[model samples]
Target: MLGVEAQKSPKGKWTMPPFDPRFPNQNQIHNCYQNFLDYHRCVKAMSRCGQSSQLCEYYFRVYRLLCPLSWVQRWNQQIQDGPFAGKI
Candidate 1:
C-alpha cells in the first residue's frame, strides 16, 4: 500500500516522494542527486560492514522516484566507466 506520501492524480496516476526535511527547497534536483549518491554510499558502507543492502532501500526509492530515467542511466554509465564525480 502507498503511504501518506503517495498522492493520486485525477487520472489515477500515483505520485511519489514525500517531503524530505533535509531538502526543503522547491527544486528537487539536488535532493535527487543526493539520494542517488546516498544509495550508493549506503550500499558500499553496508557491504563493507557485512550488513544487508536492504537497509539502503529508502535511499534507492527516493532517488528512483525523483531522478529522471535518462539522468540515472547516464550516471550509471559514468559509474561503470569510472567517470562519476560523486564521492560514492
Candidate 2:
C-alpha cells in the first residue's frame, strides 16, 4: 500500500504512483518484512488472475529502499531452500 494509489489507468491496471519520499525511512526491519510479504501476496494474487505484474513493482521498489541487502538475501535463500519455496 505504500506506493499503491487509488488511481487507475485507462486499461484498468493499477499504476504505481510516485513513492512518498518519507516512506523509505519510516519503518523498522520487521515492518519492512511485513511489507515484503504483502508485496508477494499482491503479486501472487494479481498473477493468479492473469493481470499484469506491473503493480507489484512498487512493492519491490519500496522494499529495495527500505531493507538491507543482507535481509533480502536471507529471505531469498529461505524462499529457495525452505518451506517458503514455491510460495513467494
Candidate 3:
C-alpha cells in the first residue's frame, strides 16, 4: 500500500513490479536523502577502481523523483567540492 504504485517507463508504459514496501514509516524527504547518500557511495566505490557506474543509475533516478530541485542543487555543490567530487 506504500511506495509508488505506477511510474512512467522510458517507453511511456506503466508497469507494476512485485509490491515491496520499503521505508513504510519514513517520509519521502528522508527517503530522498538516504537514497542520495547511497547513490553517491555507490558511485564512489564503483569509480574508485575504474568500474562503470551504469549500475548506480537506479538510485539517481529514485532520488530525482523524491527530492526537490533545491536539495539537488545543494547536494550537487557539496559533491563537487567534497571528497566525492568527480566520482558521481
Best lDDT goes to which candidate? 1
Which RMSD values do the candidates have, in order? 7.9, 9.1, 8.5
**Candidate 3 per-residue lDDT over residues 1-88, each given as its tens digit:** 0123222222322233222267565466667877778777887788898998667767766776777868777777676667544334
After superposing all C-alphas onto the true structure, candidate 3 shows an RMSD in angstroms of: 8.5
Query: lDDT of all predictions, in order shown?
Result: 0.78, 0.61, 0.62
**lDDT of each residue in 1-88, candidate 1, tens digit only:** 1223331112323367788998898899999999989988988898999998777777777887788878987887888889889999
TM-score of candidate 3 relative to the true fold: 0.65
Could you give candidate 2's per-residue lDDT for residues 1-88 as a string of tens digits? 2232421222333434344554555445655676677677887799899997778776666565567768766776676567563345
lDDT comparing candidate 3 with the true structure: 0.62
Which candidate leads in TM-score?
1
Better of 2 and 3 by TM-score: 3
Q: Candidate 3: misplaced stretches above 4 Å?
A: 1-22, 83-88
Evaluated at residue 8, the lDDT of candidate 2 is 26
Number of colliding residue pairs in model 2: 0
**Pairs with steric clashes in candidate 2:** none
